[model samples]
Target: MSFEVGQKVAGKVTGITHFGAFVSLPDNKTGLIHISEISDSYIKDINTVLTVGQEVEVKVLTIAADGKISLSLRQANEQAKPETTGRPKPAFNKENDRNYNKQPQSDQAPRFNKSSAAPSRSSYTPNQNNSPKKEGDFDSLMSGFLKDSEDRLSSLRRNTEGKRGGRGGRRS
Candidate 1:
């Protein structure tokens, strides 16, 4: 029987390699399941995940012109399981959005109360003697970032210029 892409087929693991596993499909066809496709998580050893003569349900991923079939063990397993999200999402509509944020709603999480969190403005004022604040100026922020990067590069060079000894070093 011929297999098409995305077709779930039952097969027996015929061989295992460091990179993947060879599975014998019907009609004497064989497919390779790459190590990455073996599991949802990392599999340190292919043997640990599969063995010769083990039955598995694999989804056909690709059928190359050269008669090579790429299969996925994980994809087939995912198909067998149903997804579960705790709460059903509300359908988006203009009416629901218009009422949002006007008042507190039980369904929504509590919003951060800015007024309650901060001290009264009359109680806290900046001292006139302090340096000018750099908040909200794009030019000042960009220049500060560039200056810090330049200083870091200069210090890194100072620390590594001698330790990076290699054939590229200039002849004295």
Candidate 2:
């Protein structure tokens, strides 16, 4: 039998594979219904949807020069459904008046209050003693850091000076 693209033909499922199912067509011809073409929904397994020797209606999608045929069960099923008029007419709101000529009340750009737009610093107050309390708090933190730095420098200088004096002679 001569097979053409878009022709719906009934065939028996001969083999099921991970990728697709092979359907044996009339005249000893065979076609593959890819896992995707098997159904409109996601198919995790082809065995769940098709079985060997099961009959299925498939639409011929393509015929390769090598005599390979590609078929789609979904396309055949889609052809069975009646076509709709596209979309239903949208329902209109009767109460709302369509104002085509009314200009916006104010043409000037809308004014926004600056204070409410962003968070204020006064809203947050840290409770911990280590946390800075006010603007001058940073100065106290800097003074403490400076004192600690000076103490560390003095201790390092004393240690290095003693080590240098004890080991005055160069290694022989």
Candidate 3:
């Protein structure tokens, strides 16, 4: 039988890998059951849940242009559960909505107040002890650096001049 999207069908688990499981559908076609679709919780090992030749009900999700099929077991279960009931009730439960809207705030640990958080190292804080050097200290540092730079330039100029004189001012 041909498989359609949102249709629950049975397939045999042909192979299981770390990434996902390959299943052979009734129509002799193959589809993949991704590791994430295997269960609702974290799945560290795919082998524990599925094995070769195991029969599984899967819902076809999509068929790619390359002929690859995507299937989901959880969606099949969810869809099947609702169809069993005669009258379709609202999917949403009022109790869940009431709890969601009127839930009391627990006295848990206070959350980090990012709006009133302390300034990071990259941000400027005028009163911070580790702030930039004072104006006088900055001026003194710049003066020392300028003197050292001037000395280096003077030594470089003297060396070039001495070389020029020793070589008769300019090369022939």
Minimal lDDT window, size 10, model 2: 125-134
Task: Order candidates by lDDT, high to low.
Answer: 1, 2, 3
Compared with the true structure, what per-residue lDDT tens digits does model 2 show for residues 27-134? Answer: 999999999999999999999989999999999999999999999999999989898769887677555647655565786665787767777787554332345654
Ranking by TM-score: 1, 2, 3
Clashing pairs in 3: none
lDDT of 2 at 39: 93
Comparing 2 with 3 on lDDT, the higher-scoring candidate is 2
Tens-digit per-residue lDDT, 1-172, candidate 3: 7667878779999999899999999767999999999888899999999999999999999988888899998787776675564777769877867676775467765588788998887775333254565566777868866866787788888789767776446555
Error of 2 at 164 (Å): 41
- Those runs of model 2 whose alpha carbons end farther than 4 Å from true positions after fitting are 84-172
lDDT of 2 at 98: 73
**Candidate 1, number of clashes:** 0
- Candidate 3 RMSD to the correct structure: 15.6
